[model samples]
Target: MPVSPTYRPEPRFFDLGGEYGDPVRAADFPETRLRFRNDRAAATVGLETLTDAEWIAHFGRFVPLPGQPGPVAMRYHGHQFRHYNPDLGDGRGFLAGQLRDDEGRLLDLGTKGSGTTPWSRTADGRLTLKGGVREVLAAEMLEAQGVPTSRAFSLIETGEALQRGDEPSPTRSAVLVRLSHSHIRFGTFQRAAYFGRPDMVEALVEHSRSLYHPDLAEGDVPGFMRAVVEASARLTARWVAAGFVHGVLNTDNLNVTGESFDYGPWRFLPYYEPGFTAAYFDQTGLYAFARQPEAVFWALTQLGGALKLIADAEALTEALNGFGPAYIRELRAAFLSRLGVKSLGEAADQRLLDTTLALLREGGEAMRWEPLFHDWFGGFASSARALSGPRATLYQSKVFADFRFSLFDHEPDRPERLEAAPFARPEPEEMVIDEVETIWAAIDGGDDWTPFHEKIARLRAMGAARNPTESP
Candidate 1:
């Protein structure tokens, strides 16, 4: 296969030696059918020019890219739902390859449902087609909302029927390739700490910093922790602003780079319910809609404990302590950005944020989450457009008075965005549970992918409209 000049392979994970991971091979499926391909994401690494045959040969057949190492199942331990699980790692997938993008940032091409590894335990390492479809949708939706998340690079339907307890049995199976900034999770350090291997912990810290946070001084564990804290805080705030609930926020799922990935049972809020839980099994609402910030902070504390194996405890504690204030700052900025308004000041921004949440809380199910931001995107400048639209009565209610008054004091940032095609619609593009199920039903019942492809196209258009400066 011909290689693009821009494709720069960098198999850096191999540098970590045998202790960090084990060589793995993909399962040979009976058939390979390409389901989805993210050309936009592929363009980042210059893999967009390949023919469909070549694409399948490389991604589907698991052929190693030029100058890239073979797949390796990474080793790590994590806490699952607050329970420390020593037997946790890459059970179903592996780090397929690594490459540098146009911006010179390192990116990992990781897989899900590729095959089994030492971490597989007794469960079959296969991903249901519906699960793969859900992940693609979740990633795209989150990206459109400006959340830091992995890109669903490729999805291939492997001809197989897998048994799953979560949904109907004998469902279709698939393999998914995700493009992400890093796969080094918080659990990576926990694994090293669990084995009482301080040297391994130190080496892992140095490896991560050298690749991901090169700006930090060497041996500056505190600096690294601070950076991770801020990134995690920003991600959590963005999730809240986007009305997304990451159902399972286990330590293994939370990467050190703070990019959200490993989507399962995730959801976008239909309303502003604080206690909304995405996972049906989450009866206690541990990772609820409003408590995401707290959940993330708790994860950071675990990371801090692991880092203490090589760093000063006091410095680590100080870095961990920054999560609360950092979350508050990021939350204010995220909400303001979503509302499409320029900040007046710290005090005024906080006031507007408080009133905005209060209005959502008061309006409850009457005010859907996405429309509030979509209708009032440009703050006061969008008032006439908003008031004339579908939910005018809701906006006119006394409960929304304070939020309405708050918008008056701020100027619209890029008010021209209101003229975009997405804003012309009565409702914003939403990826609620029902819509997701409908799309899957179309596929499951008749293998009709029309709805799936249409949703992606609409979502890309919506993303382009909202983020004018970003590539769709």
Candidate 2:
């Protein structure tokens, strides 16, 4: 059952000054417009249960509720683009509140470009509809790929004018409220360290331990550091396997919850290229697809530096060192899943994937990322002499020929029994982004919805396919 737009949500509040500084109401902006409402995501984060009246009660305005304290800018410094910046925080954003899900996870509900706070500096502190839309698209696609991400809840077009680096003019305005596990970042600790505020640093660590590391009863600060290290290792491994380039994996962007946040200059590679990068400014390829693991390690070191203030230096170093084996294990799991192969010995798995990547790299300009994976999962049919035409050319290359023999004892005709097996599972109807786009397009054109309704029903039937459960 899909969540709908009309569900009512419960209300909760948090003092925003701890991190988020302040907020400006959308109604005050001239170009404000209501652009999109992501009801599906709202439902997932437990906000979709909000009734119409309740929605009005909570977010209709930016006023503080009874006992709700005033917001303040969270003070923190960070390393941006590998250079240390001793000042960075919720410059253009503020936390509206916080909510606990049915699973008892505390999530920060915050807004971007909501308005100016003490940290706003010289900027207008506003967001454009374009930025909001891109975030929606990116978050939805990433969620489907099993990445832990900050979920976008409401995007309201402020109809006010705004300027940005990506757009031509200060034409449209918008505000994006997001739900995230926690906004405490690596920079939070960096700020305390820079100020020589060990007490504040310790206090922040304790707060974080209470929030994200509730199970840290074993080794105090050392255990908490280890948990964060392991979570980051696993998170980064998934980022690499998903072909995601975060572009700017700065210390400020590294959330304590180990979820990916701050979607900027991110791109999913069309094919596997270690040098591929999303941020145009990253000419040095510091945060390229292949370098993410190392970048994560560097960030973890910064984390270790902060933990050192609270715990023993040697213990923190030992915990941070766990990233290597943890990363390899995760990478192997992801690779095996993509290859549609049952458990393979570590050596065999590495050889198989490494050989395949080598084959793709040899293709250079002609390579397509998914096809290599798709083709190999299709039984490397050319090796069996069962593939024909364009696909046969894939095998003709001298680069791939050497590995073909390694995959098969002797190239035989397609395995008769396996050849007829079904390929991918039929996609879900309501869940397909393409179908949803068509429906929205029709609505935008102001067309009669009766015909569209019938079309959707037929398409839904075509999209449904039942099969035995299997992991891939």
Model 2: lDDT to the true structure: 0.63
CA-lDDT, candidates in order? 0.92, 0.63
Top TM-score prediction, candidate number: 1
Model 1 lDDT per residue over 240-264, tens place: 9999999999899998788999969
lDDT of 2 at 146: 55
Candidate 1: stretches off by over 4 Å: none
Sum up the clashes in candidate 1: 0
lDDT (Cα, tens digit) per residue for candidate 2, span 172-230: 66778777887888888888888777776677777777777888873388888888888
- Clash number for model 2? 19
Query: In angstroms, what RMSD does candidate 2 have relative to the true structure?
Result: 6.6
lDDT of 1: 0.92
